[model samples]
Target: MTESDIITAVNEVFCEEFEVPLKELTPESQIFDDLGLDSLDVVDLIVALQKKFGVQVRNDERVREVRTLQDLYDLLEVIKREQTSA
Candidate 1:
């Protein structure tokens, strides 16, 4: 999938799973501050993202570093590249 596809899919997951407004989702949007997701909600988000991308990111150290929507998009891109290369 292209980067655009990844961004769209991730945004869709947030909209569907967390009821976040589409207008609120942007690359710079903070997942916790802007999106109103708490620690517990983040765990749910991680699960949703794993299911959406079909990738195991919950145990990945990089997950803890994600703070913005751009961060997530970048992380997924990296994961996708690593998977394909492997």
Candidate 2:
């Protein structure tokens, strides 16, 4: 899928998982402080991302590297590019 497609999917999941309005979840929003997502929530977010994007998030270390919504978008873009090539 394209980067926009992945971002849309990720945003949907984030809104649902965080129980926050879509308008509140922006690219600059931080997953922890801004979104109030704890470690477990982060795991769930990664799982949702992997499922939606058909990408493997692998481990906590990798997931922890993601802070802002843009980071998630970038990660998804990389995964989508790899999937397209393979």
Candidate 3:
């Protein structure tokens, strides 16, 4: 998958999961601060991303590094690359 694909999927998941508008979703948007999502929502977001991308979204220290939409897009790209290569 491409970066745009990841961005689209992330936006879709956030919009559906958090009831947020598409216009508000941007690369710079912070998932927690901008979207007003709490810790529990982050767990759900990880689960949703893993299911959608069929990649392991591990609940580890790296997960905490996901702050902005760009971070998530980068994560998804890396996951996709690693999974496909594996």
| Cα lDDT listed for each candidate | 0.93, 0.79, 0.86
Put down candidate 3 lDDT per residue, 1-86, tens digits, no spaces: 87888889989998887779999899999989998889988888888888888888875466778889898898889878987999
Candidate 1 residue-wise lDDT, 4-63, digit = tens: 999999999999998889999989999889999999999999899889989989889998
For model 2 the local lDDT of residue 46 reads 75
Residue 20, model 2: Cα distance from true site in angstroms: 1.6
Residue 66 C-alpha lDDT in model 3: 87
Query: What's model 2's TM-score?
Result: 0.85
lDDT score at residue 14, model 2, on the 0-100 scale: 76
Q: lDDT by residue for model 2 over 4-83, one digit each (tens)?
A: 78778888997776678898789999989998889877778778777777778865355568889998898778767766
TM-score of every candidate relative to the true structure: 0.97, 0.85, 0.92
Per TM-score, what order, best first? 1, 3, 2
- Clash pairs of candidate 1? none
Which stretches in model 3 have alpha-carbon errors above 4 Å? Answer: none
